[model samples]
Target: MGWAVARFDFSWGDAEYHQETLENLKAAIKSTKKLCAVMLDTVGPELQVVNKSEKAITLKADDKVILTPNQGQEATSEVLPINFAGLSKAVKQGDTIFIGQYLFTGSETTSVWLEVDEVKSEDVVCVIKNSATLAGSLFTLHASQIHIDLPTLSNEDKQAIMTWGVQNKIDFISLSYTRHAEDVREAREFLSKLGDLSQTQIFAKIENVEGLTHFDEILQEADGIILSRGNLGIDLPPEKVFLFQKSAVYKCNMAGKPAVVTRVVDSMTDNLRPTRAEATDVANAVLDGCDAILLGAETLRGLYPIETISTIGKICAEAEKVSNQDQYFKKTVKYVGEPMSHLESIASSAVRAAIKVKATVIICFTSSGRAARLIAKYRPTMPVLSVVIPRLKTNQLKWSFTGAFEARQSLIVRGLFPLLADPRHPAESTNATNESVLKVALDHGKASGVIKSHDRVVVCQKVGDASVVKIIELED
Candidate 1:
C-alpha cells in the first residue's frame, strides 16, 4: 500500500502539548495498520516590527521584551532579555523597538519622552521567535511533515532548520507558500552547505501563481512537490486552480518527481466522517498519478483523525487496483532521458527487467536509499522491498515508493543459503558468481530453518557499477 503523511499545524502555545498529542495520534494510527509522518507549520510573514525612536536605536541580543499586541499578530523574532547596562547602550531618547513582521513597534509615550533622562529602566517589547521552538517540540514527536515558512526565514534560522534535520534525521522538509525557482534553489543550497541535502529531502509547496509558472525550474531542485490546493485556490480562481492542479501533477510525473495532493479532501475536519465528494476527490487524485496524498486538518487535529487516514488508505488502494498502471507508465516513460549516473542506469534496467520477466517482487539493497529512489522514479507495478542494515534507513525510504518493506541484513543472508545450495531451482541462480549479493536477495526467505522453503523471490542489488537482477527458487 502507498504511504501517506499526516500534517499538523501549530502556533507557539501548542509546543508544550505537542508530545502528548503526537503519542496519542501515533498509537491510534498504529492500531489501524497505518503509518504517519509529522509536519510542523512554523511562523509565517504575518508579523512586522516598528521602531518609535526619533533617533535610530540599536537592539541588542539581551532585552526583556513584553509584546503589547499579541492577539492577532504572532511573533517571529527570538526573545532575549537585556541587563540594565546593556539596555542603556541599546536604546536612545525617543526610540521604539519593533520585533515581529506585523508592524508592532515599541514606542515611548509622549510623557515618557519628556523624562527620558530620568528613566531608570525601559521595556523592549517584541514578538517571540516561536517557529523554532515549535519545530524542536515536534521533532521530539518525530513528525512526518516538519514544515517551516521560508519567506520569514533568516539566514541563521535557515541554518538551524537544516542542522535540526541533519541531527534528528528528518525525512521531508516542506517549504510553505513557495513562489519561485530561486526559493527552491536557495533552500537546496543552504541544505547542501550544511551537508544535509543528501539525507533530508525537500518538498516544495506550490501555493501561488508564480510557483505554477516556474514549476519546471522549481521541480528541478526539489525532490518533490506538494499541491497545496487550499492556498492555491485562495490565490487564484477556482476553475484556474483546478486546471493548474492537473497540469502540475502531470508535470511532476513527467519530471520524475513525486507530487502530493493536499487540502481539505474531506469536509469532515470538524465532523467525524467524510462527505461523498471528499472520497471521490481523493480517488480521482490517486487515478491522476499522485505519488501520495496528504491529510491536513482531517488527520492532524480533526475529530476523527484515525478514521480519516483509514478511509483514505482504503480509497487509494481500491483506486490503484482498478487504475491503469500501464497508462501512467507509458505517459511517464517518454519523459525519461539519458541516464545521468551508473545507479540511474541500473535502476532503469531493473524496471525494464521487472517488466520483461513479469517479476512478482523487486528487492533492493541500499545504504543511502538512492538506489531505491531511482527505481521508484520508474514507478514499477510489483512491490519494492528496500532492505537496509539500519532501521532508520527504512524510515527514510517512505518518500520513494509505497510498498517499501524493511528486512534485517542478517535475515536476508540466512534466507538465501538454501537457494544457493540447490541447483534444481526453477529460476537462474548466480550464487557461484562474484555478484553473490544479488543471489542472496533473490533467495530471501527460501530456506527451511529460517524461512519456508517453497517461497519464490527476485532480488536486485548494485554490484560494481551495475545493478544485478536475479530470480531464484526455494527448496524445503
Candidate 2:
C-alpha cells in the first residue's frame, strides 16, 4: 500500500515551481523512499509594535522619542505609539531599548536604539542612540529588574494554531517566549481543549532570561527546545547566547529530546548567498551536535527562500558527513522519560548493534512513534526509518520531516527518516506471517534504496515473538 503525498504551496506565489518540485520529490520518494521533510516556519507570539505608518520613520541619534500605550498612531521622531502599555512602567532611567523590523542585520541602523531618560505614568522619554527606522516592529527592553507580563499564547497565536496549524496538519508547534514549564503546560492544556494534543507536538522556544532560568523544568514538558538566537542575543550577549546554545543542545541530546538552533542564517534573508560568518555559524551549530538548524526570516519572508533552504541543507549535510563520530558519540545521555526505561534500553542496544555491524539503516516499527523518538535519542550514524502505522501519527511525522518543529521533532537528526507503512500488506505483512515487521522493512528498504539486494540492515521492533532487534541480510 502506498501513502498519498501531502503537498503545501509556499507563499512566494511560485505555484508552478512548487508543483513541479512536489511532483519531483514524490517521484523520487516513490522510487527511492529517501526524502527530506521541509517545514515552513509560522509566525508565533513575538511582541512588536503595530506601526501605522506607510513607511518606516527614520530616527537619528539624539532624537527625542515617546513610548505611548496606543496603536495605529503614526510614529514620528517626537512621538511613537506602542501597542504594549506596560512598556512605560517596565523601563527606567539609563535602560536600553531596541525597536525594529526584527531583521538581524547586525547593524544598529536597522533598529532604533534608545536610552531611557525618564518614566511617566503612561509614557517614557528616551534619546535615540543610533539612526534607525521605527516601523511596526517589536522592541527589546534591556533592564535587569523590568517585568513584562506577556501571555504564553496570544489570541492571534491561538487563532493561527486553530486555523493554520490544525487545518493544515502542522506537525510541530513552537511556543515562542516560553518563560517556564507552566507556560508549556498551559499551551498543552489549551491544545488539549482544542483536541489537538496528539495531532501536533509542542516545542518551547528558549529566548529570554526567564526561559534560560527555568530551562530544566521547561524541558520536562517540552518535546524540544529551540534556541532562538535572535531574541536570545537581545537578552544575553551574543557570546553568551552561543554558549547557551551549545549548553542547551547538549542538555537536549543528553535528555534524548531534539534540540534546534534557530536563526543560524538570518543574513540569508536579504542575500541570495550566506555570509562567511553565517556559513560558519551553520557549520558550528552542526558541529556542536544540534539536531537541526532553523531558517527563520530566510525562509519566512526572505528574497530567496528555496535557495536558502538548499544552501543550509548542503552545509548541514556536509558538516555531518565529516563530523567526528568520537565527539558525536562521546556523551552520556540520560533518558527523559522514566517509564520508558525498558524501551529506551532496547533502543540503546539496537543503536550499538547498528554501529557494530556498520549497518546501513535502522528500521523501527512503532504505533505511537515512541520507539522512533527513543532511537533518535541515541543519535546513530546510519539512517533511521521509523515505520509508523497510525494514520494521524503518520501524517504528523510527515510534518516533522518539514522541520515544522525543528527543535523537538525533525528529519534532520543524524539520518532519521519517518514513513507510514501498513503492517498488513501481503507483500510486506500478513495475518498468517509473524514476520510482518521484517517484510515491511524489506519492502520499504528496497523501494527507498536505503536497503538494496544483500545490503546489511538492522530492524528494531516489539512484535509478538521477534527480537527487539536483529541483523538481517537483504536478498534480491
Candidate 3:
C-alpha cells in the first residue's frame, strides 16, 4: 500500500463534510507524492438511532427502554426508536445489541450495550447493560448472533451513490454487507444507470457470514475486495475474522484483484503509537501480499492521523523488503491452467522478463488496465507503468476524466503507476502503434525518476488479437 485510500463511512454523520473532506484528501498526497484513492462506503442495511429530538439520552445500567422500528421519533429513556423497520423481527429475546464504535475489549464503555427482553408487534423491549451517553440522531447498531434480514442496497445507499458519489466523481464505491454476486451486480447496474458515473470501480466489503460464504462469486463480480475486519468481528466470532481475512486475501492474490484489509491499527485511534499486536498485524498483511491496508477509526477520528499512516506505511515497506514474492508467484503458477489467456500469458511474461533482465521497470499499454493488473499479480520487484487509453462511446465527449479516471482507478492496485495517454498518431480506432504507446510510458517513467538513459525495461501491449512482450534498453 504505497498511496493511501480514503474511505468515507456514510453511516455516522451528515453528508455536508463529505464533499469538503473529499476535496482536501484529493489534493493531499502521500510521502510518495502520489494522489490517494477515494472510496465511498455506503450505509448499507445497518441499523441506526433515530433520535429526532436532537438531544443525548443519558442511560445507566439496568434502565429499561423500548425499541421501535420507526424513523425520526423523539428519544427518551422509556422509548427509543431505530431507523430499521424490521427490528422487532430481526432480534429475539436475550439477543445482545452493541451500539456505536468497536474500540471496546472488556469493561470499556466505548459502546452502549442492550439486551432484548421482549419482541412486540412493532417494538422491541430492552434494558441498558452499561452507562453511556447516546447521541441524538446518530450511532450505528449491531445485533450479536443475529443476521439482520436486509437488502444489499438500502434506500439511503442508493440515494448516496446517485447523488453524492456520482457528483463527486469518486474513484471507488464499496458495497457494504455484500451477500453474493448478485448484490455486487445490483450496485454495478445501479451505477451504470447514471451513465458516466460507471467509471468508478465497485468493491465488495465482506462483513457478514453470507458474504464470506459466497466470496468466490462476489470476487468475480467486484472490482476489488475490502476485508472489513471491524464489522466482521461483530458479525462472526472475533477469532473467525482472522481466518476469513487470510482465506479472502489468498483468493484475491490468485485472482489478481486488489484486496484491502481494514482496522489493522485500531488502537492507534486512541494512542499515538500502535500496540505491538497492531504493528504485527500490519506487517503480516503486507507479507501476505494484501494490495492495501485501510485505517478506519485510526484516521477517521484518531488523534494522530498523519502519524498513523506513516507508522503503517513504514511497516508495510519494511515487511515488503523481506517478503518472499517469488514464492507467491510460484504458488500462483500451480493454480493457473494450461494454455493461459492472452492477457494472462503476456502479463506473466512481462513480469518474468523484467525480473530475469533486471529491468528497472515494466511498462504496459492497456485499454482496460487488465494487463497492468495481471502484471501486478506476479509481484515483480520493479513497478509497472500502465499507459491506459480510455474507451469512450460515441455520445461521450473526449476529455481528462475518460482516460484519467481509468488511470486513477488503477491506483489502488499494488505496484502500478497508471497514466492517461494519447498516441502520437492515431486512426479512427483507439488502437495506436506500439511505438506511440512506448513513447508516452517511457516519458512518464523518465520524468518520475523511474527511468533514465540505458535503463532496461519490459514492455507489453495488445497486438490485433494477440499480445506482445519485449525487453528493451532505453536510449537517449
TM-score of 1: 0.62
Q: Which window of 10 residues has the lowest lDDT sum in candidate 3? A: 101-110
CA lDDT, every model vs. true structure: 0.51, 0.67, 0.79
Best by TM-score: 3
Can you rank all candidates by TM-score, best first?
A: 3, 2, 1
lDDT of 2 by residue, 1-476 (tens): 11112223232224355456656765876698444443323334354555555456788898788877767566677777776777776787998777766534456777767789898888888898888765444443333324567687777667656665564455566787788899889888877876543446777888778889999999999887888777778778657777888888878888778787877777778888898998998898888878766665666568987788789888887888887754455454333434546787788788888888988888886656677777877778888887765422234445322222322243545556766554344212433443764576678777767777777888887656544688887777
Segments in model 2 whose C-alpha atoms lie over 4 Å from true places: 1-45, 135-145, 333-340, 391-414, 423-437, 465-467
Q: Order the numbered candidates by lDDT, best leading.
A: 3, 2, 1
Error of 1 at 337 (Å): 4.5
Query: Which scores greater on lDDT, model 1 or model 2?
Result: 2
RMSD of each: 13.2, 6.0, 3.2
Question: Can you give the TM-score per candidate against the true fold?
Answer: 0.62, 0.83, 0.89
In terms of lDDT, which candidate is strongest?
3
TM-score of 3: 0.89
Residue-level lDDT of model 1, residues 210-292, one tens digit each, is 67878888888887888877556544666776688788887876666777887745456667666788788888887776877
Worst 10 residues of 2 by lDDT: 1-10
Candidate 2's TM-score: 0.83
